[model samples]
Target: MAEVIKSLNLLESLKESIEKNNISDIKDAVEDMLISRINIALVGERGGEKAAFINSLRGLGVGNEGAALCPSSAAPDELAVFPNPKHPDFRLWDLPAIPSNTPFDPENYLERYKIIRYNSIIMTFTQNSSSNMVAVWREARSLQKDVYFALLASDKDTEKTLEAKKKASLEVLKAEGVSQPKVLLVCPTALEKLEFLMLLEVMLGDLPEIRAHALLLALPTFSSTLVAKKKEAFKALGWAAASLSAGVSAIPVPLVASMVDASIAVRILTKAQISLCLDDESVERLARQRGMDPTKLKGLRTCLLSVEISKSEVKRRLSVAEKDTSTATTKLVELAMPRHARSVSRSFTVMLQAINSAIDDMSADADKIIAVATGVSQ
Candidate 1:
């Protein structure tokens, strides 16, 4: 049987870190969780639809501002980087295409591309997988990297041809000593369909635990699975912030804790709004991409935090949150930190309650917006 791993209790660690008044560690933790670098490398031939795949993953259209330049050509020694407009820290890199005639050195290629820095690598192909790329894939596996094979299909491909391509790719990988290889057949223009979400889920499973939450929040698509994962991620974020606030205000002064919690609430809610694409800019961007009126998209918002998230607004909400000692919030606090359930202040519980409620509302707004954009009933 596999050994069970014990998860780290971050709240406990934060409490200890705060006992020494060492807010730096918890502060750094929060910042890292909020804006960590997540780099993905895409290795494909020029005009192999790498740019389209990257743009789709980043939720950008070809003509949109900050969209990746399609049909990319790059020098053999360098990697071309494309940053997500909403989250600059997340990037997609287009690695230079392998030379067909040259004797490829997988080790040298991996080193030249600086593959170690990337969180994941995706090898995309329109045709069969190149022996050279497969060699690099093998080398990447030896280094314990999360590498995937993706077959880029287009609107022209029929079901039979798509399955044929996937089978051919798998055969190539298996022949090259890959056991039970899984190939993702992806249509770049239609990421909401087919194996794209499956690919995302697989990658999430393979990624480091710390990165799973970030990846979930960073994804631009609005699906039921993603919505659920995003809610859990935001809940964890809220818990972290609440725990940190309680630590900072160790004396448990309701006024001081309330102020700290309010500030943290603003940060969390603002991030939630953008992550769910409910912010004005994101909504307008989504509308423009769909060739719809921005006002129509904006009108669907029913959440308080869906609009602009201001400090004054957040404070007002917290004032109201502090008034009602909701049983749901109390139970959540108890479940989150059982040992300190009795001692955790009212302000901390209230902050969690308010943050949780706001996230749910924003999630609902996101669902409504997606339904309207896709002309599907929610």
Candidate 2:
């Protein structure tokens, strides 16, 4: 009896360990399997608009140069898999609908077509009054574990009509105890309604858990030419400051010039108002209309101001020019004034000066912020 108890205790301990540790390991292994081989299958009735719906999900069209999948019209009972551009691990299968008055054995159909291997099923429907659709949904729910319903309703139909159809379909799914099915509505012909289809692609492409976690975490920083320009300017400023601190006699003129040029380019690109409104023609026109002699204006131009100025400075310059309209030509000059040119020049000089004095201060503040963010630096 004592030997029996000892053996039983050992078995219990092993079971407990498995329940605590092995269960998580098993779940992780299963999830990895699903992630590696998960396939999304689209199934609907013949001539039911499933092909067009699949094309939209794949960001393709019938006659487009880059089609994700070329669907056949004659073969109503065919299946096609859309190519994934971003993720090649999973497959997207497009299955033709079952014919009407065909064998109604759901288990046999699923097994015959090997539909049970799919990770998710997208059932398409044109109308809510489809009896075959209800049967398919019922069968799918019984056999397939994860299923989503997508309604390819007509775009020309009134909003009331679409809403009624959607509600009816939702009710049917609810009646079968299918809770919170991921529903997507597509209007193949309507270009305006393509956003929903694109959203559906993103949702299906991302793992559910990853998508959920993304909502809580900060979004990935987008790096553009503008961002690169800013980083370059920051680095340049640091270098200039370091050079000045070491009592370097001559600054690298080319390096400084390049930094200034890049900074000006970035500033010009970002300022929509200045970039668009004040071109060379506009400046010339203002000078011509204001009757301010272009020669006199050119003579007045002293130094190419050190750097670009702020938006406030541009506005102020415009305001000053507007107020100083002693001559019609001057007034036109006010209207056509290169507000950005002066500000940009001034900012460049100010930034260069700041590089020397405030480098340590700026770097320290940036480091503190980075430290507080717990290794997250932008």
Candidate 3:
């Protein structure tokens, strides 16, 4: 309940910030969201696990060009950056090996890579935490940066095991003054942890609400819970999108009936498709992963964002809907957007129906995908 209230407050705060167009208040948020650049540095001991984890985040196979560099021995003491193959905006940077012989300098190390400048940090561990890692963790926290603790517990285990690992990590971190270290026992490739989703939630905290909203929309759709979060993230966007449609189409023409800005509508729907990873390519990849035909998967797009509907097609649907002698759609739109909708309200109705209908369709599509992936019918 508190979380829900917090979320609502943040959403409203962010919207207010954006609406007022206060440059300083929103410059970082706008830059982060618009550029879609989220820098997360993996700082830890040299090992293949962290490297493999980085690759898994990219969704690439073992031999792919941008594959996570998994070295049997210590990888060199240099930073390696990997762009998310699916999401160009998401980046993973692997910090250099921890020097065993020399005295570790957190300030110099952080400065050398400018890791201090990254949006987030993940200190990866398998066996146990190290002093150098603890040093970096304290340094990052001291600098007021978001730092997460990740444990590569790839092998499926009981919830008991997850909690035990998290508890131990928490105890160690508490001594270092980290009261609550968000720990994720995630298998990077499979993404099999509720805690992983929780970790993402943690990362969004203190960020501008709109920036958080953008990150939620742009995140790679991984879990059903994540899909739900994405939906909530987009709920407020519907009105803005509808307004854009209405605003763009308010030309001085004869009132022939309801009208919609097809171009704006198309752009909105296209962005939703891309943001939700429901485009042709993403759907195909998902299908292949499930050993199913991509053709069969087209019907799997129950989520409006995931559905493969184009702008022209959406426009056609809206046009048909406007003349369909259908008062039910018209009434629904009327009820949804009645405030200050006097002159161009009819056009608002057209857009409201178009977007609302897409939301319904794409939500179902998301359900289908989750059902297939989780083997639990929605």
Candidate 4:
């Protein structure tokens, strides 16, 4: 497809810029991949369920840093924003709940919360508030905003009760003039379930391709399936990191290229490790939330970078790469060549190998952690 070619060309252009040692262009390209803004509004009641859902989506716990503040009761006039701890560019806005007893004003709701700026508006409805939610949905629809409905289900909810709740929501929407209604039933306490994945798939389908990719990378690894998907997305990032590494290590000073390669690998792999939730913070939080000992859970991580991502460790990996003379040159090395041709070529190849191996190991560790957290067999 032409679009695919354009995408590939854009990456090639970035590689060219990096090869030219354009530091500003390299930073901008890397920033575009890591810090693209994505705003999603969760229009729902101020309660534990919504808070937990927000935290789960952002891959945080109720009390963790950057987690959504869980309110004790519902407030229909408050707006709280929570940034993803790992990816601050992706924000979750908790908008005011729809009033069940009063006449709801869609215009004021839309303007007061600045709903127009949101990439997507998710109206989370309880059993009794679908009517007001439908009112807001109609307005959001008119503005051509991506909108969705969700109903929180608890562990106590039986199949029949959940179906009844979903049916009741659809009936309310139908009465309010919506031709067809779909309410996603999500368990806020457990986001790795089938329903939540379905909801995520629908949302991703509607998002622009680039934004969808950003969202996919920003989201926490909730399941093995998600880990696998993230692994594929991170491959492109791996190449980008390698190009940047090669650009920075173009210096001709003896041993400078090797040292610079190790440093760049550490920086890139550290970010990758954190994004995969292989960091000590995420592991400890998971252990605390699941009532397990943190040390034991940390012991389960298999990736070298997962254990530690430092210059010394990365240098060791680079040494291993150098010793393994049979390393295959990747497209990244071919596409991006620096000033010191020979030194940069070898350094880039070693960095690429280390980065590729690190990404694979981190992804596997992420999947293992998710399996343990969800009690699912890998």
In terms of lDDT, which candidate is stronger, 1 or 3?
Answer: 1
TM-scores for every predicted model? 0.90, 0.40, 0.76, 0.82
Better of 1 and 3 by TM-score: 1
User: Compared with the true structure, what per-residue lDDT tens digits does model 4 show for residues 1-378?
Assistant: 122223333476655676567756765666566557899999877767788888888877776766666663334576778788788788888898876666768888899999999988888755544677777888898999999888887667788898898888888888988887778888886787638788888888898756776788788777888887667666666565656666666655677666656665676777678777788988888788788888877888977788778787778777887777343454445545634444556656676677667788888888888888778997
Q: What is the C-alpha lDDT of each candidate?
A: 0.75, 0.41, 0.61, 0.74
The reply for model 1, stretches above 4 Å from the true place, is 1-24, 252-255, 338-341
lDDT of each residue in 269-363, candidate 3, tens digit only = 66567666677876666666557778876777655446565665787767764655247545544433434443555665566566656765675
Best TM-score among the predictions, by candidate number: 1
Question: What lDDT tens digits, residue by residue, belong to model 2 across residues 32-61?
Answer: 322344466777764426655555443334
Off by over 4 Å in 4: 1-10, 15-23, 62-75, 100-103, 174-180, 208-210, 246-260, 322-348
Model 3's number of clashes is 11
| Candidates ranked by TM-score | 1, 4, 3, 2
Please list all clashing residue pairs in model 4, or write none if there are none: none
Q: What is the lDDT of candidate 1?
A: 0.75
Q: Is candidate 2 or candidate 3 better by TM-score?
A: 3
